[model samples]
Target: MDCLNCFEITARLHMYIDRELNSEEIAIVQEHLEDCPSCECRFHFDMRIKRLVHERCTIQHAPQHLREAVMRLAHAPAGTYAELDPELVKEIKADLKGGG
Candidate 1:
Protein backbone atom coordinates (compact mmCIF):
# COMPACT_ATOMS: atom_id res chain seq x y z
CA MET A 1 0.00 0.00 0.00
CA ASP A 2 1.26 3.48 -0.92
CA CYS A 3 1.73 6.02 1.90
CA LEU A 4 -0.58 9.08 1.64
CA ASN A 5 1.92 11.79 2.53
CA CYS A 6 5.62 11.06 2.64
CA PHE A 7 6.58 14.55 3.87
CA GLU A 8 4.10 15.28 6.67
CA ILE A 9 4.22 11.69 7.91
CA THR A 10 8.01 11.82 8.45
CA ALA A 11 7.37 14.37 11.18
CA ARG A 12 5.68 11.85 13.50
CA LEU A 13 6.86 8.57 11.93
CA HIS A 14 9.05 7.67 14.91
CA MET A 15 6.21 8.04 17.42
CA TYR A 16 3.91 5.96 15.22
CA ILE A 17 6.52 3.22 14.70
CA ASP A 18 7.01 3.04 18.48
CA ARG A 19 3.30 2.33 18.95
CA GLU A 20 3.16 5.22 21.39
CA LEU A 21 -0.05 6.53 19.81
CA ASN A 22 -3.49 5.45 21.08
CA SER A 23 -5.88 3.24 19.03
CA GLU A 24 -7.62 6.16 17.30
CA GLU A 25 -4.25 7.67 16.34
CA ILE A 26 -2.99 4.27 15.15
CA ALA A 27 -5.91 4.08 12.74
CA ILE A 28 -5.09 7.47 11.27
CA VAL A 29 -1.41 6.54 10.84
CA GLN A 30 -2.31 3.21 9.25
CA GLU A 31 -4.68 4.90 6.82
CA HIS A 32 -2.04 7.43 5.83
CA LEU A 33 0.69 4.80 5.41
CA GLU A 34 -1.60 2.62 3.37
CA ASP A 35 -2.05 5.47 0.87
CA CYS A 36 1.54 6.86 0.69
CA PRO A 37 4.73 5.19 -0.56
CA SER A 38 7.14 7.85 0.72
CA CYS A 39 5.68 7.60 4.22
CA GLU A 40 6.12 3.80 4.18
CA CYS A 41 9.78 4.33 3.22
CA ARG A 42 10.23 6.80 6.06
CA PHE A 43 8.63 4.39 8.52
CA HIS A 44 10.91 1.59 7.36
CA PHE A 45 13.95 3.84 7.73
CA ASP A 46 12.94 4.81 11.27
CA MET A 47 12.44 1.17 12.21
CA ARG A 48 15.96 0.35 10.93
CA ILE A 49 17.44 3.10 13.11
CA LYS A 50 15.62 1.85 16.22
CA ARG A 51 16.73 -1.72 15.59
CA LEU A 52 20.36 -0.62 15.24
CA VAL A 53 20.22 1.33 18.49
CA HIS A 54 18.80 -1.68 20.35
CA GLU A 55 21.50 -3.95 18.95
CA ARG A 56 24.48 -1.66 19.70
CA CYS A 57 23.64 0.04 23.01
CA THR A 58 24.44 -1.57 26.38
CA ILE A 59 23.17 -0.71 29.87
CA GLN A 60 25.59 0.04 32.71
CA HIS A 61 25.43 -0.71 36.45
CA ALA A 62 25.72 2.14 38.99
CA PRO A 63 28.68 2.06 41.37
CA GLN A 64 28.17 0.98 45.02
CA HIS A 65 29.24 4.40 46.38
CA LEU A 66 26.83 6.13 44.01
CA ARG A 67 23.92 4.13 45.46
CA GLU A 68 25.00 4.95 49.06
CA ALA A 69 25.33 8.66 48.20
CA VAL A 70 21.80 8.61 46.75
CA MET A 71 20.50 6.98 49.93
CA ARG A 72 22.07 9.73 52.06
CA LEU A 73 20.79 12.50 49.76
CA ALA A 74 17.28 11.05 49.79
CA HIS A 75 17.23 11.01 53.62
CA ALA A 76 18.40 14.63 53.91
CA PRO A 77 16.24 17.37 55.53
CA ALA A 78 12.81 18.31 54.07
CA GLY A 79 13.70 21.99 53.43
CA THR A 80 17.11 21.09 51.97
CA TYR A 81 16.19 20.69 48.30
CA ALA A 82 19.78 20.41 47.05
CA GLU A 83 22.89 22.62 47.02
CA LEU A 84 21.08 25.05 49.36
CA ASP A 85 22.67 28.46 50.04
CA PRO A 86 22.35 29.72 53.63
CA GLU A 87 22.92 33.33 52.45
CA LEU A 88 20.17 32.99 49.82
CA VAL A 89 17.73 31.56 52.37
CA LYS A 90 18.29 34.60 54.58
CA GLU A 91 17.78 36.90 51.58
CA ILE A 92 14.49 35.15 50.68
CA LYS A 93 13.23 35.47 54.29
CA ALA A 94 14.16 39.20 54.32
CA ASP A 95 12.33 39.71 51.03
CA LEU A 96 9.21 38.01 52.40
CA LYS A 97 9.35 40.37 55.42
CA GLY A 98 9.64 43.44 53.07
CA GLY A 99 13.14 44.12 54.58
CA GLY A 100 16.63 43.94 52.99
Candidate 2:
Protein backbone atom coordinates (compact mmCIF):
# COMPACT_ATOMS: atom_id res chain seq x y z
CA MET A 1 0.00 0.00 0.00
CA ASP A 2 1.11 3.53 -0.69
CA CYS A 3 2.14 5.64 2.30
CA LEU A 4 -0.85 7.34 3.93
CA ASN A 5 -0.76 11.00 4.79
CA CYS A 6 -1.82 12.30 8.23
CA PHE A 7 -5.20 13.48 6.99
CA GLU A 8 -6.03 10.13 5.46
CA ILE A 9 -4.94 8.24 8.56
CA THR A 10 -6.88 10.51 10.88
CA ALA A 11 -9.95 10.40 8.67
CA ARG A 12 -10.05 6.60 8.83
CA LEU A 13 -9.06 6.52 12.51
CA HIS A 14 -12.49 5.78 13.87
CA MET A 15 -12.86 2.89 11.47
CA TYR A 16 -9.43 1.64 12.50
CA ILE A 17 -10.33 1.92 16.16
CA ASP A 18 -13.56 0.04 15.56
CA ARG A 19 -11.77 -2.59 13.44
CA GLU A 20 -14.09 -1.84 10.54
CA LEU A 21 -11.30 -1.48 7.98
CA ASN A 22 -10.07 -4.35 5.78
CA SER A 23 -6.69 -5.96 6.39
CA GLU A 24 -5.02 -3.89 3.66
CA GLU A 25 -6.41 -0.65 5.06
CA ILE A 26 -5.46 -1.63 8.58
CA ALA A 27 -1.95 -2.46 7.43
CA ILE A 28 -1.65 0.91 5.78
CA VAL A 29 -2.76 2.68 8.96
CA GLN A 30 -0.40 0.61 11.13
CA GLU A 31 2.47 1.37 8.81
CA HIS A 32 1.70 5.06 8.99
CA LEU A 33 1.49 5.00 12.77
CA GLU A 34 4.81 3.16 13.02
CA ASP A 35 6.47 5.96 11.03
CA CYS A 36 4.49 8.93 12.42
CA PRO A 37 4.73 9.96 16.08
CA SER A 38 2.08 12.67 15.86
CA CYS A 39 -0.57 10.36 14.45
CA GLU A 40 0.34 7.77 17.07
CA CYS A 41 -0.23 10.30 19.81
CA ARG A 42 -3.55 11.26 18.27
CA PHE A 43 -4.47 7.59 18.00
CA HIS A 44 -3.78 7.11 21.71
CA PHE A 45 -5.77 10.21 22.63
CA ASP A 46 -8.71 9.15 20.50
CA MET A 47 -8.58 5.65 21.95
CA ARG A 48 -8.73 7.08 25.44
CA ILE A 49 -11.78 9.13 24.48
CA LYS A 50 -13.43 6.08 22.93
CA ARG A 51 -12.80 4.04 26.07
CA LEU A 52 -14.09 6.80 28.31
CA VAL A 53 -17.30 7.11 26.32
CA HIS A 54 -17.83 3.36 26.28
CA GLU A 55 -17.36 3.13 30.03
CA ARG A 56 -19.68 6.02 30.74
CA CYS A 57 -22.36 4.83 28.31
CA THR A 58 -22.52 1.28 29.66
CA ILE A 59 -25.95 0.55 31.19
CA GLN A 60 -26.21 0.46 34.96
CA HIS A 61 -29.19 0.35 37.27
CA ALA A 62 -30.46 3.72 38.36
CA PRO A 63 -30.68 4.45 42.09
CA GLN A 64 -33.81 3.14 43.67
CA HIS A 65 -34.95 6.63 44.73
CA LEU A 66 -34.40 7.97 41.23
CA ARG A 67 -36.32 5.04 39.76
CA GLU A 68 -39.17 5.72 42.15
CA ALA A 69 -39.18 9.41 41.25
CA VAL A 70 -39.33 8.59 37.56
CA MET A 71 -42.20 6.17 38.21
CA ARG A 72 -44.06 8.89 40.07
CA LEU A 73 -43.59 11.29 37.20
CA ALA A 74 -44.68 8.65 34.75
CA HIS A 75 -47.87 8.02 36.70
CA ALA A 76 -48.69 11.64 37.48
CA PRO A 77 -51.69 13.26 35.82
CA ALA A 78 -51.23 16.02 33.30
CA GLY A 79 -50.42 19.46 34.75
CA THR A 80 -49.43 17.97 38.10
CA TYR A 81 -46.07 19.15 39.43
CA ALA A 82 -43.85 16.46 40.91
CA GLU A 83 -41.53 17.71 43.58
CA LEU A 84 -37.86 16.95 42.97
CA ASP A 85 -35.12 16.79 45.55
CA PRO A 86 -33.42 20.19 45.68
CA GLU A 87 -29.92 18.69 45.59
CA LEU A 88 -30.87 16.50 42.66
CA VAL A 89 -32.19 19.55 40.83
CA LYS A 90 -28.96 21.42 41.48
CA GLU A 91 -26.86 18.48 40.36
CA ILE A 92 -28.93 18.16 37.18
CA LYS A 93 -28.51 21.85 36.49
CA ALA A 94 -24.78 21.57 37.00
CA ASP A 95 -24.63 18.63 34.59
CA LEU A 96 -26.55 20.62 31.98
CA LYS A 97 -24.00 23.40 32.37
CA GLY A 98 -21.15 20.88 31.88
CA GLY A 99 -19.93 21.37 35.42
CA GLY A 100 -20.73 17.86 36.61
How high a TM-score does candidate 2 get? 0.59
Candidate 1: residue 47 Cα off by (Å): 0.1
Per-prediction TM-score: 0.51, 0.59
Question: What digit string (tens of lDDT, one per residue) describes model 2 on residues 1-100?
Answer: 6888999999999999999999999999999999999999999999999999999999977656667778889999999998898887776566557733
Best by TM-score: 2
lDDT of 2: 0.89
- CA lDDT of every candidate: 0.70, 0.89
> In candidate 1, what are the lDDT values of residues 1-100, reduced to their tens digit?
2333556567767878888877776777888888877777778888998999988896655445445556767999988866535665565566557732
Candidate 1 residue spans exceeding 4 A from truth: 1-5, 60-100
- Poorest stretch of ten by lDDT in candidate 2: 91-100
* Count of backbone clashes, every candidate in sequence: 7, 0
Model 1 compared with the native: what TM-score?
0.51
